[model samples]
Target: MIQRFLAPHRTVAAGMLGRLARRAAVCALAFGIAGAHAQETSSIVIKGKDGWLFPGWGSLTQVDVRGIDNTTRLIGQARDLLAARGIKLEVLLLPDKTLFYEDRLPDGQTLSPEVKARYGLILCKLGQAGISTFDDAAVLRQLKASGQEVFYRTDQHWTQASADATAEAMARMIGRDVAKLDGRPGTGMTLGPLFNERRYGDLAELFLTADEKKQVGREVYSVRRQAESSNLVDDAPAPVHVTGHSMVQPYFGFPQKLSSLIGRPVSVNWNPGNVGPWIVLLEYVESPAFRQQRPQVLVWQMFEPTFAQGPDASGLWDNASIMSANAWLDRLKTALSH
Candidate 1:
């Protein structure tokens, strides 16, 4: 009797069940596609504790200091390699922005107690290895505390003030008094800027979405030289050579300020940001310019986060062009022999 009663609706029941299953499959596929897209865009930017935005990779959450030992060894070996050729290698590690602005990090985000001390750790290691270095983090902090913006609010680069301070500190480390170096009083070299131009920062363009880019805005003040400027003059190859990423580029004023502070011209070679210091260093050493005019001092500037990262992390250098840290040290030794 039950079969007879239910048999009438069985066909309808089966069709309904089939439709439900198909709908569920469609929903699952849609969600899968959405999830993939979300993962891809999740790294664009992160919200900081105080409404500040930061690059996801540059966040303290992604930091891995376990590679510190390998990094230390690489620095020591590189120092030795350069020393054999009578060239002093000075390493300048720029601290990550997240370290100094921890108070602005996201609410749930927390730094390991040791994270704050990482800069000191690197300095200690470099010092033990007998490599010349400037206490960049300390200097930047002091500058910041004194009301000077050492770093841009929306960009990762150091401000001109910070660059000036570092240049002075570096000069002291090399035993070059800026006063004595600037022996020519009438040469017209001066740090006074003709004007300041406001422009969008790189991070404001890169990490922010189109809407966020328009809503959350930040600009950098670029100090430019005027047409009447006679302070800068053409000079021969400088005794001090600088190689690094965009931080040391001519446009950033790091090289120029450093030159003025050190009281001598300096040859700088760098590429677009994110090329990694390893490739930049290798290319500079192998360049015809370096062979023609070997510098007495080589200032190697790099960000602290990428110091331990292998060549693969750069994604800018081809495999054949880059090698492991140990292999790079060997190649450096051979290159300097000439």
Candidate 2:
């Protein structure tokens, strides 16, 4: 029964998995024998090829299928509840950086078959549960294939180019579902000129020692400034609300790009650190912002690797952010009730 349901969305081919395993074995052997130089400075930071650093928290081998199903079921329930209040919920599930830069993984490190199939499996489950989502993996892959760097080599956050691309794609999807949004004319944000800046990545700053950081070096990033003349504040309540981690923050230009492309005012709330998506959502719905005027659409963004983790992932999520799944849902229900 499960196979039948997932057949249509199964993206990983058995042959591909076999090829990946063979390639990984050869790379492991080569790196093990010849390249003895330490690539990682810290256990939590993975040093990838060509100065690319990835967070070690995301596993390249583990895929908790049951956890994914439970997460999706909860998301579906949230969707139904939001629908009752005339709000459309769209989940923006961002794929891990490892997916796009598999070749960059240090010598022997490669994604396991389960990790390769994880994104597709979650998407299938979300679909089955009647939750709205888009294939962000496909969008990022296309952006990478086009020679644009989707993510920074040194930073955990994505590049502005990728953010713009994803925002455009998301806008199109939102347009299809919502014919028009509630906002006055000329309320949308205006994007400013793009500028280049060089800096050390968050990973390099947080985990790497002084010597290790020098070795990794700084990377040039393209950033977009908001127009100086643009007035973002308006009396009309924003019809679209975004809730997510630092990835969707204004610094990355995701929410700004989304507002420009969608031509609607987009209100956003985000927290840095591993606060987890569950708590982030609760924080938003319970805030005075949600009570002032409920948005017509709510975009909930989350990382794909951590998607399977429930709200009560004690050690995985930050100490204060952790809670049982039922407890999280109960809070959500209470917040939305008013």
Candidate 3:
């Protein structure tokens, strides 16, 4: 009697259950496919030509471009402030890694036309403002043409050779004034033994997986150490001072080589490149180091990307470090008065 009572609806219920199962399976398959695609696309690393890896999100964004005029104005204002203190300001704008390695970029990635013109535009704007600028692009291109690696395959920083070349250029500029002051011809200085080391680049470490790190390998650089010279002393309060990013650090052999080439001891005060240039300059201005050993010429080295963006681009820097263009100029003026 129970079977007869349910038998009429049992067939209809079974049909409905079978259709629902089929629909659930289809939905699951679609979601599974989408999830896999999203995982692949969200990876931070992209494979580049010849086993190189590029950061998927490393390029400059709209915010950086929007802030260029403001950044440039601040730089010019800094020059004016330093000029008031009777100190010379030399702006060294290091070109982006992509500038030298565009051919090795990851597949489907292209440097925008605006980025291609960024360095030249920066130089032009700075020159128009009468700020002393270094032509790093021309020098790097010349080195690259001569088969010297201007930048590492996986790193955002320049090679030791490129750093040395930049130092040499700085030495030439600084040497001229020193020669004029001392009433002597500029002497040809020398560097010591070559030191070799194997290292991983910051970008490589940031983007590569363990397997990729092993596969892509590390870059070896033979850095030049400062030689024991009769003329140069280590402890003197040198007239030339360098303040910038990691590029000017002693590890990269920039200051040492710069000292060797200029025939005099040099001083360097630098920080990690990410802290932004405005903070570095402002802090240096207010520090006891600046008060005790003021430099006759200060070399401010910075990368193009960082130079393009205003201080608050990442919002990672402190309030004391980040401010508007006008505010920064006012602060610079205040710092100079003290």
Candidate 4:
């Protein structure tokens, strides 16, 4: 009797209808979002340069033609300007943290050497300009080989230890002895904005194991000197100046670390910008307050993507001071002589 009642129309008709409607809705969304993929040879067969399978969906967007063409001119101008200001400028293009973890590309596809070379060319061009750049990939690989980790696997920024290594490298790049750089002694009292505020926890969750976040922010950040000739005495003065991205700010104790290298408390102009990082960096260094610092060593930290975008096409902020960057360059030139 039950079979006869169910067999009147079909089995599980309502359940099947719900599933079909849901699938159709999802497909409609995919078609709406990635309409370009609608031109596939088959209803479900889409092909790419390497028989690339889209699996459930395809990326219909086209690659933009713009990339790193004018980095040289902009960097050359900034370097010349900074040099005139009597600063020793060093540029370090931090590698995309995703490049190493293989997060950007599809699974099972190894990052090709061509991709790496494309990444490396930015540094190569900087070298051609007679500007010193720290090779992040090389340094990261070396540190890993030495049983010392440089980056958190998931985060896009460096670990404090990595930041320390970077400070040392910057000192060497500026012809200053790395031994002079020192880590700030921890306050041994309380933590700073990082832990107290819980900023960057999402990104940190990717790179840090459970143990790494414990070391994120500190107060004193004291360090025992490793460089015999560079040890900090009881009352040494901080250094002239430091300028870079959020990476070099004192909260991570980068200023103190660099001061240890330079045998003083390193002043800094670190602004994390919504505009391009270089413009932000350039604007800060050229500012009157920052200008007064009179640093001999100027540390510039940017990522590979900055080289890709370059300065010619940079998004200028409404308040961007690049208009006067030229005059600042002239001032910097005079500083270089001092």
lDDT of each: 0.60, 0.77, 0.63, 0.45
Q: Give the C-alpha lDDT of model 2.
A: 0.77
Query: Candidate 3 residues 1-338, lDDT tens each?
Result: 01000000011145643553344334334323111110112234557788665544335222233355456666766776787797888888888777777788766777665556667766665665566877899999999999998877776667889988898887787755344322122332355788898877776777778887877888886776555552443244556677787777766777767756665556666666557677777666666667776677888887775565567655434455677766666766776677
Q: Which pairs clash inside model 3?
A: none
Candidate 2 backbone clash number: 0
> Ten residues in a row with the worst lDDT in model 3?
1-10
Candidate 1 lDDT tens digits, 1-338 = 01100000010145643553344334334323111110111254566653366655443433334344345556666766777777778787888777777777778776554445556665664655456787889888898899887766667677777777787777677664122432232332345464566765677777677776666565757664533443334444466778887776655566666555555556777765456677677777777677887877788887775565655453434444456666676666667777
Off by over 4 Å in 3: 1-47, 54-66, 175-190, 229-234, 314-320
> Cα miss at 272, model 1 (Å)?
3.8
Candidate 3, residue 191: the lDDT equals: 59
Of models 2 and 3, which has the larger lDDT? 2
Models ranked on TM-score: 2, 3, 1, 4
Local lDDT at 74 for model 1: 64
Highest lDDT model number: 2
**Which residue pairs come into collision in candidate 1?**
49-105, 49-106, 188-231
lDDT of 4: 0.45
Q: How does residue 229 of candidate 1 score in lDDT?
A: 46
List residue ranges in candidate 2 displaced over 4 A. 1-42
Clashing pairs in 2: none
Q: Model 4 segments beyond 4 Å from truth?
A: 1-67, 103-112, 176-200, 204-240, 311-338
